[model samples]
Target chain A: MTATLGCVTLSLADRLTDLTLSLHEGEVTAICGPNGAGKSTLLSCLGGLVAADGGLVTLGGRLMRNVPVQERARSIGYLPQSPEIAWDVSVEVLVSLGRLPWGDAGAKIGRDAIEEAIAAMDLGALRNRRVSRLSGGERARALMARVLATCPAWLLADEPLANLDLRHAIALMRRFREQAGKGRGVVLVLHDLATAMNFADRVIVLDRGRLAADGEPAHALRSEVIEQVWGCKAGWLGERGMRALSLG
Target chain B: MNRRLILILVAALVVAVPLSLLAGRVWIDPIAPTTRNAALILFELRLPRAALALVIGAGLGVSGAAMQGYLRNPLADPGLFGIAPGAALGAVLSFWAGYAASVWLLPVFALVGAGGAMALLALIAGREGGVALFTMAGLMIASLAGALTSLAISLSPTPFAMSEIVTWLMGALADRSWREVGIAAPLTLIGVGVLLSAGRGLDALTLGEVAARSLGLEPRRLQARMIVGVGLAVGAAVAVAGVIGFVGLMVPHLVRPLTDRRPSSLMVPSALAGALLLLVADCLCRVLPLSGGELRLGIALSLLGAPFFLKLLLDMRRGLA
Candidate 1:
């Protein structure tokens, strides 16, 4: 499935004007931008959770606006920048919420899907524990597990790696890669440009709500592109697939 | 739904409702039941009062659970939406207008007030129906209704009318006939149906608004359901039983520990628990020896709820609950 954004413009005072992008299944894409650069906004628009003031978003072929809400939810899984668990439910219970779009959630309908998501997030041991008792990293994984339980065609997450430790972060990146390997689209909003360069198949950089760069990591995030978009002198260090950002 | 809790509450209610009839001021003996007005008291008087208690209590419980879920705040209550206050304001107006002499008009007036409040709340919150804005609108309406009710009370034409208003506002099921039961039951049932329909949406909200919306939980639709459900259920309760307090606010908390802790999971159990609590409390009110008269059900609950609230606060403080 292809999620297409055509000249999508959002007026939030920090305008996202005439931005067009396409995301494909079976690939990992990263959206990188400075704060207030419309990264989350763009992701929300693509997920059909927010309506763009101008232009259109098409999921596969149908306009996202015209897509039924439950169908859209079934097709797209969205994780907010900092998801909150309102109730102190068990991790298993929390993860089962992803199956909500399928209806009969917490029942036997999506049991296998929930198990797969819980396994993918490595939350087997902690399934019975309350979300309120989980640490920040654990909570983040639980939130991720909830989205993954939906088994949507497209997974759009904002700042998904912020609270993870190195091992968990690496593990999660591998998990995301596995999802993409299974012919799913993985779109993440990343503040870590190095991680985007190292892990993402495609990177799109937004500057002041405009598309500053869009392509392979090496080309779109070249030293000059970084300097021009970020307004700072920076250079990429290390070899491909393990790149780091070195500042002057 | 917590099956064990439901069973326990239902069993307890089954026992308590019958015993409540026996324990009232006229203590009817089960064995050798040959009292002059035993049949009249049991069938006509206590039966309807007990039914009203159950209906109103269950309504309050479900409303409280739904409100807490919608706000994602444990402290939210049926009164938060201003429907109860709006109903009170309407009833007070009836008294102030010297229309309290008419039985049907008072309840009709209160129902109209509740509808008006529901409309104003929806209008103020608008289509987005975001939680924060919805809560703020509720507060605005509640405060306005409260001020207006106070004004009506203070400026009541006669001391007799003022006394009647104060006593009624204390909240009770005393002297209520099957008529109150008829008015409250259908409304509460329909209201519960509406709230139960919003269960999935409330469950989705465990992940907060954005993620819930992503899960196909429409905020505006949920808000509309809450407005209508709470308006009807709580409005009917207050219209018949006066401002019976704390059942909606307290029942969910009392039942939450027994359930899965999900908002949807807590709702039915809360309703059962609320019914049980109100029945027992109303029973105690009927039997309690007060020189002035039988203890008012509203005062009885507030007395219980205040301490429960303080304990909840302290438990939260200690992270033990």
Candidate 2:
């Protein structure tokens, strides 16, 4: 599905305005900003989890505002920040819930989809294990598997790599890249600047609820913008292609 | 630990229900033929009482598990949300005010009261997203219902009315007939159906409201359907069996560990465990000798449940820690 976010705007109390730009398909976008910059809120509006005061979101040539919530979910898979697992559901069963919008009729994680998701997330060992008992990193991977089970046209994730360690975090980013390559628009909210630059095809930077920069990560990560908005000095550390920043 | 304990408990309950029935006022061996009165008592009285206990117990267990999962709080109970107390108050007021001249009147009023409380609580809880606020409102509504029930019982002119109210409050299945079972059976089944239909929503809700909404679930609609279903089942059970406590609270806790903390998986097992727990408790009430008279099942459950509740709180604290 071709998903587009057109001139989306949100207003909060105390006269705060959040202006977001439209998103395009076949691209992996990373949203990055300091805390309380409305990065998550932008993702929420895009995923149709929250209503916007202005702007239209159209998917596959139809206005999303007119589509039902469940129907919207069928085309869009979302992961909110700090997602809760209300019970100790097994990983396999939890992942299977991604297929709920299709009702009983749709071909959900039949053996093939479930196996593919588990193997993709490297959660084959944990599939039968209880989610509550899994460690933070393991649980995050399991939740990712759940989102993948739906096989939506777009994937929206909020700080999904927060709990994952280095190796697993890289693996997950690669997975997102792979999904994006498969013609799915993957929108990610990332706290890690290094990974966003290394993995994201494009980065959308927000500053105090407004879109500050939207383009290549290298352009968005300019020294003046980083120094002014983040109050940090961006530093390049040698041939490793790793960028570091020092908060003044 | 979970699987072994469930099996043992189920076995004990299976054995104990028949044993309790056989060891009643008339001591007749299941194998031996004694006086016709003994056989009649076993067939007509004890059997039906056991059956009612099982069904109502299972209903409370499943409903309680569903409620806790729905609200995402272990402290929540049918009474905390006003369904149980509301049903009880409705039945008692009907009884004391002489509105229930016929059997169906009490059940109908009780169901209505239960449904009303659910609607009111849903309005109060759903508007406010926090779990604490929802439970607090539920507690307040329960208190209000409790006060009304007490006042209605006190104002009764009948000489035996106060004792009947006390007995109902204590909760008993001692003399419950097949008719009461018939009334509760179909309603409880309906309630079970409601709980199962919402099972998927409950599963999604575990990931919190935002996650659930993103998955396209309307939280308000799910809350309405769930509360109504719980109230109907609990109200019907209360209308027939009086106000029994602990089944809803204890059964889910006992069965949750067995399912490895999956609320969806716990639903069926919790129901089974709840039925067995109530049956065993009722049996103990029948066999355990009290110097003055028969021990009420509610008192027995409270005696056991108080300590279990403390343990649960400690475990929760440790989890948080």
Candidate 3:
């Protein structure tokens, strides 16, 4: 399902204003901006984790505000920035939590989905491991599995790879790319310009809470726009055919 | 096998109970097999005491595990929500006014007091988001209610009543009769049923309220069910055996790691562990040189739990740092 956030405005006692930009489906949309640019907040609005003061958010042609949380959850999967583990459940049991919207934890489809998601994440060996004992990269992958197990039409991940090593980070982005290729709309918030250029199919750059740039990664990473929004310089780099930018 | 633990617990119950029946101020040797005296001691005295301890321990342990699982906090206890102090107040007031002399009077009042505390805490915690705020509010209310109960007990008239009140506050499984069993058993069973029914919700809650909400759980509704269920079960326990400490606090923590931290699986095992712990403690109170010493079960639990609690606090502080 496609998500639409229109003219969305957020205010913190009128001192900070976070402007909203709209997003669509079946594409990997990366939200990038400088500090205090409200990139994460825009993603929250689209994920229905936070309510916008002004405009409305609609998912699958229905107003999100009017839709029930369970109905909304069925169509949208949200992963917050720095997701907290509230308890020490096993990886398999934790992933099984994603199927809760379908029915009881003991339901046949719920169990099958949990097993499939764990297999998809290549966590078969670690399914029985306690979440507390998993390494940072493994934990990120496990949570991705959990979000995927929900089987939502849209995926919202906020910095899904911030704590990962270089290799693991790319693998996580690649996983998102694969999901988008499977026709699931993926909206993620990231600050890394290099990863956004290489991985995101569509880029939505926020500059001081406004939509500074929204287009193909190559077009959105233009030298002047990058310098203006991120307070940095952008230039073509290396044999990888990727745009590289330096944050000043 | 886990089933072996259940068998051992049952056997311990059988042995300790008869031994308790034979002891007391008047000794009746079951080997002699007397008609009136043996029957009286078995039926009226030790039978009730043993049953009381078993049921109360089982209820506290089950509810405690349920609370910890529901709150996703190892430190969470049935008493964390103020119901213990509330039940104590109700029981002390009933005794002071001489109403507790009537059968089931004290239990009824205890239920009311516990229900009131549970309702109050649930309402207050419901306003604040997250488990942390809920626990903080519960602790505050418990402290307040405990202070009020102390005041009421100090002002009681009968000199003997004062000592009785003291033992009750410290918690004991002494001089129980079959009537107390009749009052506690059915209520506790019903409470256990309610908690078990909410097992799926508890599983969802461990992932945090936002995740639980996303998973089609109304956290507020679940919290309400937890408060009511725990209050009913624990209040019945308090009504029969005073305020036993730590079963609810300790059992879940001890078994969670063994059960791989799966809350659904931990519930029954924790209940079993709780029953075993209480039965052992009660047996220790009977034969272990401290029999006539007005031994408080709460004192024993505190002696054991103090260091454990301190260690847990230190670990939490380190983690936060």
Per-model TM-score versus the true fold? 0.97, 0.87, 0.86
A1-248 per-residue lDDT for model 1 (tens digits):
12373222222212577776777888899999899888888888888887765656787677777789999899899999878888889999999999989985656759988998999989999999998899877888888899989989888899889878888787778888888999888899999998899889999998988888999999889988889888889998888998889997
CAPRI grade of model 2: medium
Where is the poorest 10-residue window by lDDT in model 2 chain A? A7-16
Candidate 3 structure quality by residue, lDDT tens digits, A1-248: 12263221222211125443455566898888888887776776676666655555676566667778787777778787888777777898789878767754578777777888898889999998988889998899898888888888888888888889998998888889888888788888887888988888778776775667788887887677888886666575743435565444
TM-score of chain A of each: 0.93, 0.86, 0.89
Top of the candidates by DockQ: 1
Show where candidate 3 strays beyond 4 Å: A1-22, A51-54, A104-107, A233-241, B1-36, B100-104, B157-159, B291-294, B308-321
Q: Runs in model 2 with CA error above 4 Å?
A: A1-20, A103-109, A163-168, A231-241, A246-248, B1-21, B99-109, B126-133, B150-160
* DockQ of every candidate: 0.89, 0.61, 0.48
Model 3: CAPRI class: acceptable
- Overlapping backbone residue pairs in candidate 1 total 0
Better candidate number, 1 or 2, judged by DockQ: 1
Winner by TM-score: 1
Worst 10 residues of 1 chain B by lDDT: B96-105
- Residue-level lDDT of model 1, residues B34-54, one tens digit each, is 787999999999999889989
